[model samples]
Target chain A: MRIALLGGTGDVGEGLALRWGYHSSHDVVVGSRDPDDAHAAADEYEATLDAHGRDAKFTGFENAMAADRADVVVLAVPPYHVADTVEAVADRLDAGDIIVTPAAGLTRDDEGFHYHPPSAGSVTALVADAAPDGVPVVGAFHSLAAGRLADLDADLDVDTLLLADDESAKDTVAGLTEDIDGLRALDAGGLANAAEVESLTPLLINVAQRNDDLWDLGVRFQ
Target chain B: MRIALLGGTGDVGEGLALRWGYHSSHDVVVGSRDPDDAHAAADEYEATLDAHGRDAKFTGFENAMAADRADVVVLAVPPYHVADTVEAVADRLDAGDIIVTPAAGLTRDDEGFHYHPPSAGSVTALVADAAPDGVPVVGAFHSLAAGRLADLDADLDVDTLLLADDESAKDTVAGLTEDIDGLRALDAGGLANAAEVESLTPLLINVAQRNDDLWDLGVRFQ
Candidate 1:
């Protein structure tokens, strides 16, 4: 499959590109607002894979260009940037293409952290609203740790909750999600249940904060 | 130090209880809404420690009683129950007692998961508001995964973010967080930053959902 990591200069985007390039046969492209940065990241990633004895084809381009050439486009930006990022690439997205978002808005206070949804309900909804008509926007990957993902040597066994209204789009994303070894993809109903799933991140972080033994903690549903 | 897991039947509660009981001299107590459940969980934890030849003292009680007896009380409950849980156990809590909350409110929609804060802003703030006056409320453990924690055999080399208005309480929670092996505690500023920390959960979950090969995902700052 042709996959594009929009905002591919970021920690999560870089991690995704490395993994897809090294672990799968899919074509991986790095996208950034600055094409130069994207190309530079692609070079670094390719070198890292080369050092590890994997010869994978990785390309770089502007965000819109990356989205235009791919079957799947992942918005790997921060929660605050989700809508703007999608809007910037909206024209490049096609009818059959899938767009996925994993951003969650949050707030903090004297005691600890909590989710802060946009007035539109969730960050994912914001992205979907910003996308051009006819494109499928799927909500997913809202609970992954960037550092853990960037570590290509690490073996992961974890579960990801999937939420989307478009069944076909969700299934396509689900198929993509489970393709990686040791990762489990679960259907967490639909987009309406997204808040419940997204909220778990802060809970997990808080648990890791108080406990002594867990750090960079990941969840695996029994 | 005396530690109490107020909802010890849950994954995060059990994990914290087991780790402290097995790895330290701190007195570990299992607390639940139902004292019987606490007793059962305590018994199992004790047996696990005993099999490993660790001489750690563990006990069980209702959450209120547990809070009354411990220097530290972990309100390890779901997001929706945080305030009520703290309120329910408020009277038993003393001035020097430290109360910690790891819950994050989030909402979902057609796109993906996003953080959902209560009307008061962050869940942590709500906890402090609900807590008795003078009883220090510290927000910690907002991002660790339960499956990684419950497994005694897992290797955790991750960082826990801490936020609080009380420096002493934050320091205390930080000390407790790093008591276990392979964990680092980071000062992610004060309560003002709790929203940023807590909001990362749903974003991580969303990333896990959309990506292939990530599960039980965690975060580690570079």
Candidate 2:
């Protein structure tokens, strides 16, 4: 499968790019508004893969061009940029193509980080509303720590909750997710439950902040 | 500490009563609308503890009476009943007393369960509004599985997310939570974040429903 990481210069985008590029057979395309930045990030990802003894070719493109050729597009943008990112690539997505959102709305106060969901209820729903017709949106990887995921030395026994309205699209994304070594994918019902999945990101961050030993925490269900 | 389990005949109430009664030195009081039911449930809980070779005393009382004597009151009632349960026990809660809510609003469909938060944003918030002034409300144990908690034989490595505005009260509740063997309590922030903690319940249920080996799943952050 070909996977496009939109906003591919960001932390989450880079994490997904390196993991998928190193661990799986999926062709990874790094996408950004600036073609130069995308190419730079793709070069960095390729170097990391090479250090790990994997020779993987990563393509860099403008967001639209990247989305146009991929079977799956991951909105690795920040929460506020998810809708616009999806809109920018809307014309490129086909009916059967899958869009995955790892973005979560979070607001911080004196106490700790709290979930600040979009008016559409969740980032997944925001992308669902903004995407072109017939393109299915799936919410996954919301609870993962970017620092932990990007560290190839860290053995992940972490689980990612998957949510989507379309079963086939959800299954496709789940399969892609499990291909990353040691990461388990659990179906967390349909799009209506996206808020629950997205909210976990802030909760995990808050927990990590309070505990000394629990830095960059990731959730595992047993 | 004296801990009261409101709606003590219910699944959650029974699980908490059993765990606290068997694992900690705290006094466990079972409360219900009906005194007879409370007494019966308490006796059952005592018998279960006895079979496990733990000699623990359990008290049974009406909801109001239970709240009057306890230092921490746990509202183990369902989401719909949370407000009324708090209201019924409102007059009994003295200043500095703590009220804990484990209820999560859930609505199910053909696909699976989705979070249906109350108009107050979360059941914890609803109880906070209904409780008497100065009675601090803390949200904890929102994501624990009742069956796993009730089974004394099953070892728990579960983490319960705690949320509250009152720092001292939050600390008090956190200390109480760690008394239950194998349960670690993580401070998840203030009551504004309760929806995130509550919503995790249904998300866990949905994930457990879809996965075969994930029966009675519980979360551990690593």
Candidate 3:
């Protein structure tokens, strides 16, 4: 499968690129507004995989071009950029393709991080609204820490909740998630439950901030 | 410290009463609308502790009476009953008392469970509004599985997110949470973040429903 990481120069996108490139045979494409920046990130990801003695298929392209060539497009962009990013790639997406969002609307104050969901209810819901008709949108990986995910030496026995209105799209995303070795994907119903899944990111952040030993905390269900 | 479990006949309330009764030296009071029901629940909890060969302080009382004596009162009622339960005990709470709510507003359909947060933002926020002046309301244990919590043999290396504007009250609750073996409390900002914490419950339920060998799941941070 071809997986395109939109905003591939960013923290989350870079993490996903390296993990998918190193752990599986899937084609990993890095996407950015600037093609040069996307190529730079893809080179870095390639070097990291090389250090681990893994050779895999990897490429870089502008966001639209990357989406056009991929089976799954991951909107690994920041919360503020998700809607615009979807709009930029909408024309390339079709019925068989899927868009997965890991973005969560968040704000911080003197107290701590809080889930500041968009008017559409959640970032996933916002992405669903912006997606081209018949192209399914699934929400996953919202609670995983990018730093932990990027660290190849880190053993991730973590759970990533999946939510989507389309059952086949959700199953496809779940299968892709489990390809990363220790990551377990659990079905969390439909997109109506996306707010609950997105909100977990801030709670995990706050927990990591307060505990001395729990930096870059990710969730496990037992 | 005297810890009162209001609506003590219910699942969450019974779970808390048994855990506190067995794990800590603090007084555990089971409170219900009916004193007889509370006492019956208390007896059942005592028998469970006796089987484990731990003798502890345990009692039963009406909800109002329980609140009158407790340093910390846990509103273990369902989401719909939280407001009226808080109203019933308001006169009993004073400046030094603290109220903790674990209620999450949820509605289940054919698909799965979805978070149905109240207009007051969250059940914890509603409790905060209904609480007596100077009596702080802290949200904790919102994500814990009652079945897992109540099972003494279940090893819970789980995290409970605490949210409250009152730092001292949060500290007090954190201390109480640590009294239960294997449970760690992490501060999750203030009451404004309550919706995020409460919403986790429904997501957990949905996940547990869909996955095998994941029944009565609880969360751990790594």
Candidate 4:
């Protein structure tokens, strides 16, 4: 399957692009508002994977073009950009295609990061609301450590909680998740549970900030 | 230090009663709305400890009486009853004493459990609002699996995220959390982060429900 990571110049997008390019044969595409920036990121990702002695399958284009080329489009953009990105690429998304969002809304204060859900309840719901009809929107990878995920040498033995109203779409995303070695995907139920799952990112970030010995924190359930 | 578990006959409350009795030398007390119910739970907890070849320091009383007996009072009650429970025990609590709440507001439907935090933002915030001025309210243990926490034979290698406005009181609760075998405490900053920490409960529940092999799931950050 082809994957178009909208806002692929960012931290999370770069990480997912590298991981998929290194581990699987899927064609990974980078999407940005500026096609030139997307192209540069794609070249850099390819170089990084090549340096690790792995075959790289990566491409770059504008958001709409990238979305049109892939069956799975990951909205790897910031929380504030989720809705706009979905709308920008809505026309390019085909029926039965999935849009995945790892964006978690948070507000930082003197104390630390706090979960700040959108008026629609969660970032995923916001994406689902803006997405075109028949295009499934799924919430995933909301709690991954992007820096660690981008590093090929870093060992990832963590679980990613998945949420969506569509079971088939959820399973497809889960399959992509498990395709990357060491990442496990566990279904956390429908979009209603999105806030609960998305809120975990800030908690993980807070714990990681306070605990010096622990870095790039990832969660596991046992 | 003496510790009291208000609403100690319930799932989470009873689990705390058993764990503290079996693991630490601190005197553990059970508190209930009905004194008779508290007494029965205390006796049962002592018997369980005795059967495990452990000496038990367990007692029972009404909520107000229990609060008066301890420097640390844990409001291990349901989310809806938090403020009322605090009000009922307020007169018995002394200045500088700590109140710990593991309550998380959640509403369940056909889709599963969704976080239903109060208008105050989180259950911990609601608790802090109801608690007396000089008394500190700290949030802990909201994400624990009570059935696993109650079982002495189950090996618990998990982390608990703590939130509090008072640094000294937070340290005190951290010490108690560390007292339990295999339980590590990580400070998650001030009470503002409570919603993120408390919201983890429903996420764990939803994941546990979907994954058959996983039960009584506890989080470990790696």
Candidate 5:
């Protein structure tokens, strides 16, 4: 399957790009507002994979072009940019194609980081509202530690919770998620539960901050 | 410290009573609206500890009586009853006493459970508002798997995020939490972060419902 990482020049996008490039045979493409930046990120990710002795189908393009070529498109941008990113690629998304959102809105204060969701209830919901009809929007990877995900040396024996109304699209995304050896995906019910799933990101960050030894903490459900 | 589990006849209350009785030297007390029920639960908890050959300080009383006798009083009732429970025992609370709330408001439908926080933002915050000044309110254990907590055979190799504006009270609760084997307590900042922490409970329940092999799931941050 082909996968596009929109806003793939950023932190979380970089993590997903490198992980897919290393672990799966899928064609991984980086998408950015600036195609040059996307191309540069794709090259950097490909070089990292090459160092690990894996030559994979990794490339980059403008957001819409990437969406056009991909079966699954990930809006890996920050929370504020999620809707605009989806709108930018709206015309390119075809029926049966899946749009996955991993972004969560958060605001930081002197005390700590708090889950600051958008008016639509969550970033995933915001993306859902902006995307064209017939395209399934799945919420996953909302609470992943991007730094840990990018580090191939890290085992990532953690789980990612998934939320979507469409079963087929959810399953398709879940399959892609497990292609990376150590990560497991569990169904967390429908799109209405997006707020709860997205909030876990900031909660995890707060927990990680107060604990001295833990940085870039990922969650495991036991 | 004398720890009172208000509404000790319930699922979460029973779990906490048993765990504290078996794991810590703190005097564990069961409090219910009906004193008879409290006494019965206390007897049952003591019986469980006796079966395992451990002698511990365990007892029960009416809600106000329990609050009067204890340094830390846990409002272990359901979300809707939290404020009233506090009001019922308001006069019994003394200065420097602490009230802990493990409750989160949730609504369920065909899909699964959703976090239905009170207008005050979170159950913890509501409890804080209802609580009299000088008696600190700390939020912890909002996401514990009750059945696993009640079962002594199960190892609680998990973390509980704590929220409180009172640093000393938070420290006290953290110390009490670590007394239970395999449970780690991480500071999740002040009570403002309570909504995010509270939402995790329903999210976990939703995930557990969809995944057959797992039920009563607890989170561990890695």
Candidate 6:
């Protein structure tokens, strides 16, 4: 499947692109506002693959162009930019195309970090609202750490929470998420579960920060 | 240091008991509402140590008795039981004896799970309010999953967030948490950060539940 990562120059985008390029047979494409930056990141990732003696299938393009050509487009941008990014690429997204969001609207204050869902409720909902009709928007990958994800040698037994109103789109993204070697995609019910999934990231970060020697904390359920 | 597990029969208690017993010279005490249950858990844990041929010290008692004898008491109960449980054990606790809570209060609706801070604010604050005056309450281990922690074979490079108003108590618990193998401790400021740390668990669970194969999802920082 053709997968385009919007904001592919960011930490999460790079991680997802590298993992798909190295471990799966999918054609990975990097999309950015700056095509040159996207091209540079793509080249860097390819070099890392070459150094590891693996075949690389990755390319770079502008966000709209990438979204226009890809079967799956992941909005890997930050929470603040999610709506604008989706709106920027909305015209290029067509019917049956899946757009996945890992972004969660959050704010850091005197009371540490808290979920600050936008007027649309969440970043996931915001994406759904921004996309054109018939383009399915599925919320996923909101709890994974980019550091562990980007490392090919890192053996991850991690779970990625998925939420969406659309069942078929949810399944498609879930299939894509699980295909990357060690990841498992579980149904966290639907779009209502997005806040629960998104809020975990800050809590994990706080735990990792406060505890010594536990810098990169991960959860594993029984 | 003397350490007490108020809910030693549960997953987190078992993990803490095993790690501390195996790695530290500290005395480990198992506590439960049922004295017999505490004794049984202690015996089972002792057998685990005996299997490894490591003679680490452990004992069993009722919750109040265990708290009475310990320097630090850990409330390892679920979020719902935290307040009543603390109230039950309050008379037994004394000044300078620290209490720690790892519970995150959560509410799940059609829209997913969220950090449902009581009107009193975060769970840690709730715990502190329930405790008697002069008893230092600290919040740690808000995001560490019981499954990963109980598995000795799992090499978890994870973090534990520490939140406390008292510097000395926070430092002490921070040292204790890092004493466990492959766990790191971080200073997350104070109890103000409790909501952020506590909220991570449900989000992680939601993510784990939604994904295929990603059971017991965890985080690791870059």
Report the lDDT tens digits of candidate 4 across residue range A115-160: 8889998999999999999999899998899999999899999999
Candidate 1 residue-wise lDDT, A1-222, digit = tens: 998999999988987787777778888889999999999999999998998799988999999999999999999888888888888888888898999887777776554566667888777777778888888778777667666767778876766667777889989988887776656677765666666566656655655565656665566543
- Stretches > 4 Å off in candidate 2: none
lDDT digits (tens) for residues A17-126 of candidate 3: 88888778899999999999988888888888889898865789999999999999999999999999999999998788999999999998776788889999999999
In model 3, state the lDDT of residue A23: 79
Interface root mean square deviation per prediction: 8.5, 1.3, 1.3, 0.8, 0.9, 4.5
TM-score of each: 0.62, 0.95, 0.95, 0.97, 0.98, 0.74
User: Candidate 3 regions off by >4 Å?
Assistant: none
TM-score of chain B of each: 0.94, 0.99, 0.98, 0.99, 0.98, 0.94
Model 4 misplaced regions, further than 4 Å:
none
> B140-220 in candidate 6: lDDT tens per residue?
887677887776677767767678989999989989998888777778777876766676677677656655566655554
Q: What is the TM-score of chain B in candidate 2?
A: 0.99
For residues A21-129, could you state the per-residue lDDT of candidate 6 as single tens digits? 8788898889999999989999999998888778796789999988988999999999989889988898998899999999987788764666678888678888888
Task: Give the alpha-carbon lDDT of every model.
Answer: 0.78, 0.91, 0.90, 0.92, 0.91, 0.82
The ten-residue window of minimal lDDT in model 4 chain A covers A54-63
Report the C-alpha lDDT of model 5 over B23-43, residue by residue, as the tens digit: 989998899999999999888
Q: Is candidate 3 or candidate 5 better by TM-score?
A: 5
Report model 1's interface C-alpha RMSD after superposition on the true interface residues.
8.5
| Local error of candidate 2 at residue A141 (angstroms) | 1.1
Among residues 3 or more apart in sequence or in different chains, the pairs in candidate 2 whose N, CA or C atoms overlap within 3 Å are: none
> Candidate 1 on B1-222: residue-level lDDT in tens?
998898888988987887787667888889999999999989988888788788777899998899888999998898898888888888888888898887777777665676777887788888888988888778777777777776778876766677787889989988898897756677765665566667666766666575656565565643
> RMSD in angstroms, candidate 5?
1.2
Which CAPRI level is candidate 1?
A: incorrect
Model 3: lDDT equals 0.90
By DockQ, rank the candidates, best first.
4, 5, 3, 2, 6, 1
